[model samples]
Target chain A: MAQLVLSNVYKRYDDGPKGLFRKRKVHDYAVNNLSFTCEDGEFIGILGPSGCGKSTTLRMIAGLEEITEGDMYIGDIRINELPPKDRNIGLAFEDYALYPPLSVYENLAFNMRAKKIPEDKIQEAVSYVAPLLKVDDLLDMKPPALSGGQKQRVNIARAIVRRPGLLLLDEPLSHLDGKMRQTLRQEIKRMHHEIKCTTIIVTHDQMEAMSLADRIVIMKDGVLQQMGTPLEVYDDPANEFVAGFIGEPPMNLLPATIVGAGDGFEFAFEGSPLRVAVPEKYNPVVENNMQVTLGVRPVDVLIQPGTEGSGAVPVAVYENLGDERRISVRIGDTLLNTTTAEDVSYHHGQIVRLSFHAERTHLFDPKTGNRIRSNVEWR
Target chain B: MAKIELDGVTKRYGKNTALDNVSLTVEDNEFLVLFGPAGAGKTTLLKTIAGVEFPQKGLVKIGGEIVNHVEPMHRNVSMVFENYALYPHMSVYDNIASPMRSKLYKKDEAYIRETVERVTKMMKIDHLWERKPSQLSNGQRQRVAIGRCLVREPNVFLMDEPLAHLDAKLRHFMRSELKEMQSSFNTTTIYVTHDYMEAMSLADRIAVLNHGKIEQLGTSQEMYYTPCNEFVATLFGEPEINLFPAEVVAENGRLYLSALGQEGLPLEEDVCQALVHREDRSYDVGIRGNDVRFSFEHRPGWMAGTVYANEPIGNKVIMTVDVEGTHIRLVAPNDTRAGLDQPVYLSLNMKNAILFDSVDKSYVIRSDAQRFTQTAAAAGR
Candidate 1:
């Protein structure tokens, strides 16, 4: 097992020419000054949107891409100057590039054979890893004859067959269907537990990162935003982008102006009749007449059938989504979504009372988009 | 808006059957979603409605008129392809207005500008109007394609996974936006996607297809609560539905379902009554992850199991438990934690359990019917 550490790593790329007359002069930072550490045998997920430099960071760690600055260490050894072959890292990418001509057993033993490992040892390694990935039956079959899930399993088996100190997987489940993806995700988790190898997976899917990783590193536009466990990131996001990007149906971000009301602060939406009292804990971070954005997840918003209360908004759309009921209310130009139980019933155009859980509500600085975290601990 | 209908539609390409004996109806101004996995004939059905593909057998009707032999241009339907087929040379403005400039729907420049402006604004692509397709992102180009389709006052709209290529956050935003757009336009729509969530959230009715056959057609709730078969039951829901082969044993005037060497999972009285007439002993128990409950302490009627793995997925934790030899997944609160190989007790929410015939994969007992009748009998009592 290897504990990986990256200290202020940076990857820069030079832009190509835009026109015949001019050459681009500036260098683009695909990965800015980013740093994180993965403990030994720990599964870490680097998650972000496309072009967010997650893949770049993973490539740098794998020695596939050169880092322009800073040092990378694997358990006290500097590996920035080392080649990929010397890093002892097993790699599995989105494409399961298995050799079609070779059988599954041959594919698993190919890497060992190149390193001049004895015949019996290669055979023993393939046999041991095949059953672990549930590809024992597929040993004689080639990649072309196997299903997508089976092929991916074989690919992963080949990666672990070498027993490398570190394993790097990039969007390993992106190509599979929903059901197949879930099944493979469990298989990967099981394999990790059995092998106890340090692993780093880069993916854009929040659910995948949340479910698989021991810790998650969320990046955006080449900059590191937050690093925490799935629950920590989901429950208390560092910024508006992390808050909005982490959850399904997303967090509702409504631009509101803070105003003094009854010895406390209330956030009043612009050009709408919706207003919510700011939680008392946020009073220290917020000021009267200050511009702030109020953030609340869809699950945190409570909805009633009628507009009988002080904070009631008209429902624009109500959908029964089998597992849950989603209600959308238009406050100002922004559509705020609230998710309720599947059994909850509401009609379109019906007025509904809306209330945000004070403890769950988030206040953000409109200028920097950072969360206003006071001393109060979130439940 | 027009009501669309397909009667006994079957399309074949050489030896391959793309669509087999499919029939459906879309009411006027209603949004119908054709949902299935890849190669399930969702796109073919959408094309048949758009008059882009001709069916070998069956009638296609638009607005109560038979349009089986109608040309694509005369069908009065606009389609948005999975790949946004925007003209690279044309600006976003021109691309959106191209449908209006067609000979079939020729309009004055002022009217075209007004329509384009309205649609572009609605799609939030007005700022990118002057830029060509090459300059826009995938999401922006998709909006332009949708805007192009929306600019026309068509009889029906056919969208083939328009949001499939978008990122997760954008797709969620676009799903609700598309629903709102459908309502405001009041246009009949035939949307196709493999995403069950999209089908559930966007459709007034969903037609689930598999191997070119309609597996089930109903509201999202109906299909979810009363799935016709194991295939339909497993099609929706995350973690998929847990399906394990079991044997239905009747003893002592009570019913029990046993599987994987574990026995005596007692069924409710209502469920027993429903399964009494079934002669088949072999069955498949279908339970959603959320419907299965797990605890550290042993409870009566609960089966002992070992935790295979516990995955925390933000809001919920999905625990894969080994009950005997069968793997059963159960959902719990995110705060719930369990160690690997830890002994735990598992119980099913009897009200939510479903049963399927093992031989033919058909539903033997549907929980929705049991719940409905139970409520009715309670009201009567």
Candidate 2:
């Protein structure tokens, strides 16, 4: 296990129609100036939306795509120019490309045999990894005979059997069903624990990235927005995109007119005609009647309207999610959402008061969406 | 609004039964969801309701009247698939207006455009009306599909994962929008999805299907709190529910199951009954990670387990605790001080436990003797 690094990486493609054999260079900058490090035994996730150059970065690391510019290193090695086989990485992708003709056991052993490993070592390795990954019984089954989840497990086992210093999984859970995905997620987490390999996975799914990685690398349009542990990302999101992206039933962003200054102030929202108290930290930045974006998560936004606090907009629509009912309120033009205690039934268009926590509220610069300085205390 | 029904519906492709004797009712204006994993016949059920697929041995009814052998158009149902199936060449306005094109529709142009404009504004896509599908984003294209559906003023709306193609941000935005719109339209809707989040957050009631059969149906809370069996116990939530094998121990005057993993945790009446058997056998105990709590102290009702891993997700931490021979997840709050591989006590949440029989794997939670006796007396009287 070692620290993997990428420095100022870049990619460009040629696009043109000037001559029969001529082309014009188009600078796409797919991984422009991207730099990050995954430490020894660290499990980091590369997360972003579609077309965000995450896959391109992973491919570049795998030696499948040439690094257009800059240096790449695994541990102390300047391994950008090294072949994939020499780099020593266990890799898995969304699609499992297994040999249909080979049985699971044979497939696990084939990679080692190609390297001319002794039959005893191959069997030992297979036996060691098979039961840990819950694929011990599936060893004799061919690819066609196994279910999708089984095949994925075998694919992962194939990638990790050699005990590579690093592991790269690209959306490995994307192809399975919801239930199967959850089950495999537990198995993968368990596998990562027992064998502490430095892992880096690329995914567009925030839930996967948040749940699996020790720290997450968030990318957008080839630019790094933020990199931190999942707690750091979700609690103190760098901006609107990160805040909106991380949570289910995402944080409710209310466009507000910052009313007063001081530790205890009020924010009057436009459209929704609602107001909430702001903690002292936003005092200097908030100006009376100036537009600012107020961020409150469904969890932090509380009901119990009569609890001697600023109230929320009345409820208009409620979604009963069993665990929680996400209710929407119409306050002027804005819609505010808060998760009520499960089994609290409310009718549509019912008016209810909501109050945002002074400590839990977040403020962002309306135009840029960057997290503004605030006194809202958090973990 | 319409009441849609399926009776003895069975469809087969070669030897596989996509839908097997599935019968259900969708009351007028109800937001009903047919939710399941892929190939569990969710789409097939939706198609059958829309007259898209002919069921070999059943009748589909609209407004309590059988619509067997009826053409799709005559059935007056609108369908939306994952692709949206919008016409690429047609602008959003024309696409919305296309449903009205069967007749000359020249005189009805004003009415058509009005209704299109109404639904367009309602779906928040009025500005993109003149743009072709190629120019619009996936979310915008979906709105266009919904606009076309609304223009028809059909009594039934069948949506098959209409929001599957959008990004996370847009999906959340649209999830709420679809919920609000579906309620406002009062259209009898049959929504199909493989996403539990969507099913939980969007539906008035969810019908969980497995192997082409309705395993359970209820309000989202009922499904979450009282899953009919083991399959549902594990299927309905994120990070998944934890199923741990437990042994039954009958003590003096009460039923006490062995929970050595988290010692002294009170085994609720239901959990004790789930473990009850004439043969004194072991059984499975199903509890959601969110409901299970872990403590450092060896409280009387807690079991000791090793923390296998910690999965962080901002608000909560999912800790997989290994107890005995099985590993179960317990959603720890973010601020919990437990470290990885630390020996900890997992206190079973008695309030949320849904117990099942080990052999049959069915719901068999035992109620309190008092409640049972009361029900028995009431039945006798």
Candidate 3:
């Protein structure tokens, strides 16, 4: 096991010269100054959209890519100049690049053979790890004969046969179908526990990161957005991007302006008369007539039958989605989506009262897209 | 818009049977989703409907007209490829307007420009009209492809994973937009994808395919609540439905389902009556992760187990429990937490439990248990 730490890491690529006598210009940073630490035996996920430099960060840690600047430490030793072979990292990518000519057992032992480990020790290691990964019965089968899930299992087994200190998986479940992906996800969690190896997984799927990683590092355009436990990040996101990115159906980010109501502040919808009061705790930082973005998850929106007051909005689209019913209402040109239980039915064009859970609602500074926090204790 | 009908459609490429005796119907203006895993003939079926591939057997009909022998250009169906097949040299405006300018539907310049403008505005690509295909992003290119299809008043729209290449957030946004577009245009569409979420939210009905056969076809609710086989049940949910082999044991005068080495779970009166006369005793018990309840304390009907892994997803937590040798996943609240190997009690909501024939993997008894329970309660009241 190893504790990995990255401090102010940077990666930059230079564009080639276009014309004669013209110097090559340095492009934008592929990975900006990013810093984080993964404790020993802790599983962390690097999550981002494409082109966010998540893969670049992983390559740097694996010693595949040279860091442009800053220090990376494994335990107490800095490994800036170490070769990839010396990093002691196991890697499994989306493609299960297994040797088709060899049996599962041979595939698991290939790395040990390359490292010149004794046959007896290799046999011992394979015997111990194969059963843990539930591949004992599959040792004699070739990769070509195995199912997609089985091939992935053998691939992971091969990576761990060397007993590396760190395990890095890059979108391992991206190619599997939905059912197989769920099954393999559980197996990965179980394997981590049994092996107790420090692991880092890179994936664009938020659900995969939330279910498997102990902590998640969200990135965008080479910049670190937020790093926290899934619960912490989900319950209280750092900004509008994180809020909208973390949840399914995404969060509804409606433009609104803060207005004075009674003794507190309220958010008035930009294009409509709908208004929701800001929680008392946030009233200190919010001001009247301040333009802000109101963020609310679909699950937090309350929809009631019939028009009760000015808060009612007419439904534009209503869909029956198995266990839940999704209702979309058009507020000006923007459509706000809300989810309810399947039993709760609302016809399209029906008037429905909408309310927000004040505690669950979020307010953001529209200019910077950052959450508006009070000076007091606000997480 | 035209209704599409396929009767006993079968397609084969040498030794491989791409589609075998598949039959389905898409109603006029209905959004029908063809969903399955790779190698499930989803794309081939779409091509068959578009007259790109002729089935070896059976009939393809569009608006009561047989289209198996019709040329692809004369089918009046606009097909969108997974890869946005756009002309690199032409500007976005010309690419969208080309469909309206085709010889089959050539119109006056005023009519062509009006149609192109309406579709470009609807697809949110009005500002990118001057850019070529190479200058647009993947999402923008996809919108343009859809716009080309929408520009012409096509009878049927065939989309083969048009949004597969977009990022996750963009894909989610595009799904809702596609559904809204379908409804507003009132075009009969046959969309194809392997993503379950897209099938669930976007489709008026989904036809689940496996090995070129139609496993099941119904509305999303009907498919989720009353799946006819193991294949259909497994394709629908996250955390996947837990299925375990069990046996019905007649104890005294009651029938119980014994599974995972746990004490027998007494079957409901209606379920017991339904299964009492069957000679085969073995069955496959199906339960959704959301329906399985977990508690710290043991109750009479609860099965004792050990928590193997507790995974906290955003809205809910999925806990995998080991009962004897079998592992079953159950969904819990977001705040729920448990240590590995911690003792827990598991209770299944029998009302939602389904049973299947263990050997052939066919549904022996659908979940009429909920209906039976509700009816019994109403009578008692």
Candidate 1's displacement at residue A357, Å, is: 1.5
Name the lDDT of candidate 2. 0.78
The lDDT per prediction is 0.85, 0.78, 0.85
Model 3 misplacement above 4 A: A13-28, A83-88, A93-107, A110-116, A140-148, B83-98, B109-151, B249-254, B367-381
The alpha-carbon RMSD values of the candidates against the true structure, listed in the order shown, are 4.5, 5.1, 4.7
Model 1, range A1-379, lDDT digits (tens) per residue?
Answer: 8999999988886544456887423236788889999999999999999999999999999998999888999998999999999999999998999999999999999999888999999998988899888999999999999999999999899988999999999999999977789889988988898899999999999989988888999999899999998898999899999998887768889899999955678788887878778888887667779998889988899887676756888777777766667888888767788887558766667788888888888888889999888665643
Screening candidate 1 with a backbone cut-off below 3 angstroms (N, C-alpha, C), the clashing residue pairs are: none
DockQ, 0 to 1 scale, candidate 2: 0.46
Docking class of 2: acceptable
lDDT of candidate 2 over A218-316, digit per residue (tens): 988777889998888888889988888887667888777777754556887665446676667677667677777888888887665332335635566
Ranking by lDDT: 1, 3, 2
DockQ of all models, two decimals each: 0.53, 0.46, 0.51
Query: B236-341 in candidate 2: lDDT tens per residue?
Result: 7766777766666666646655544532335676555555545645667777776777887777656777777676665667688777857778777766645567
lDDT tens digits by residue: candidate 1, B14-109: 999999998888888878889988999989988888888999999999999999998988988988887889999999999999988889799999
- Using TM-score as the measure, name the better of candidate 1 and candidate 2: 1
The clash count for each model shown is 0, 26, 0
lDDT of 3 by residue, B1-381 (tens): 998999999999999999999888898988889999899999999999989899999999999999999998899999898777899999999999998787888888998888888888887689898999999876578788888988887999998998888766677666666666555566899999988878987787789999999998877765677778998988887668889998999989998888877657867788888898899999999888878999989888788899888888776788999998788998888889787789999998877788989999887885463553353244221
